[model samples]
Target: METELNVYLSEVTDDGLELSGTLDDSIYGFEDEFLKPFAGLRYELGVLHVGSELLVRGKIEQDFEAACSRCGEDFDFTVKIPDFTASFAVDEKTEFVELTTELRECILLTLPTYPVCREDCPGIEKKEEKAPDSRWDALDDLKKG
Candidate 1:
């Protein structure tokens, strides 16, 4: 279903409005080199126009390309929010409600703080043990004697 980032208050009915669509990747306009949006956000929301307030509830899904924090390997990540919800205060003058920014933040806030490529990732390579110092060789010789 095609959907816009904003909801027109006039379209709302007593039975509420159901919105389902994929918000374009442009919605995430902020700059972050590390995290790249893989695809547009898919959402299914229910909008209710109550007294002095507009309530929005639905599910949101987004895909992202992220690097593993432990190994620095690139990976795909999917964030799903089944109970996504928000509310806004409105009045007679409120013509439309902006949904892009809030939805973007919601997905970002749900992202993993330290993402990993996999659970079994071993991380960076470990260095081998060093050979004994020559100074300690003399002590070993004395012990042998």
Candidate 2:
């Protein structure tokens, strides 16, 4: 679902525009199992018209939850994604697509490669060693013969 940026764009009296909106799970797809049980995303977009170019700036803040790589336990983490800015030539066809792609890319880039349950989680426990087979013992005796 596309969150409406029309309000901000419509109010562009000057060359620069400031846009802010609250984004819940409904629009951002946070209800998926991987993204649930975490905080919501809040974002702001700023657009400026410089000459024939449109400069876009965006910021996002949210929390994420994921299973730890080693312990298989769940963990909650927060990511304050850095603001992103890009320039694009204002055109009929490419403006919206470029902005949407840039937003998705920025969010994905901010995510951690691997999330841990805790800093000190001892990994999956090692299993106990098994005793040597009786067949092996018999084979040893035969070899000694």
Candidate 3:
């Protein structure tokens, strides 16, 4: 349920239209226990109409609460696209260009496949193996005899 991101052709000016806003977390429609949205998606973009193409370029950022892949601990995470850019095909009769799907995909693609709390996060601690049972010593004696 991504929020509609449409730029009307008439809105594009010679200096390019500047669009900046924050969309609800529902825009992602991400339903995962391990990865949860912590904040809304924020975008600052410039829209331009060039020939038969609509160009959208700018920055996109979103915050999340993700579980560490190795430690299974929850941590804050942020997905940022500093140089987000996309071009859509349009025509003289086209009214507006939709950028919701493209923006969603871009954010999703930027997310880490295996998120970690930190770069040097030590994984789950491993327990030391216990010493062998003394009861096995009798069996060892029987075998020696």
Winning model by lDDT: 1
After superposition, the stretches of candidate 1 with alpha carbons farther than 4 Å from their true spots are 1-4, 126-145
Put down candidate 3 lDDT per residue, 6-107, tens digits, no spaces: 889988988889999877788778768999876678899999888888889999998999999888889998899999999999998999988888888898
The top-ranked prediction according to TM-score is: 3
Cα lDDT for residue 70, candidate 1: 83
Candidate 2 residues 1-145, lDDT tens each?
2443333333444756776655444444445454443434556877776556677777866667777777666678777766677777655343342354455456667776766676777767732356777878888899999
**What lDDT score goes with residue 128 in model 2?**
38
lDDT of 1 by residue, 38-103 (tens): 668999999999999999999999998888888787888899999999999999999999998889
- Residue 116, model 2: lDDT of 69
Candidate 3 versus truth, CA RMSD in Å, comes to: 7.9
Q: What is the TM-score of each candidate against the true structure?
A: 0.80, 0.62, 0.82
Candidates ranked by TM-score, best first?
3, 1, 2
- CA shift at 92, candidate 2, in angstroms? 7.4
Evaluation by TM-score, superior candidate among 2 and 3: 3
Task: In angstroms, give how far residue 42 of model 1 lies from its true place.
Answer: 0.8
lDDT values of the candidates?
Answer: 0.87, 0.60, 0.86
Off by over 4 Å in 3: 126-145
Write down the worst ten-residue block by lDDT for model 3. 121-130
Q: List the residue pairs that clash in candidate 2.
A: none
- Candidate 2 versus the native: TM-score? 0.62
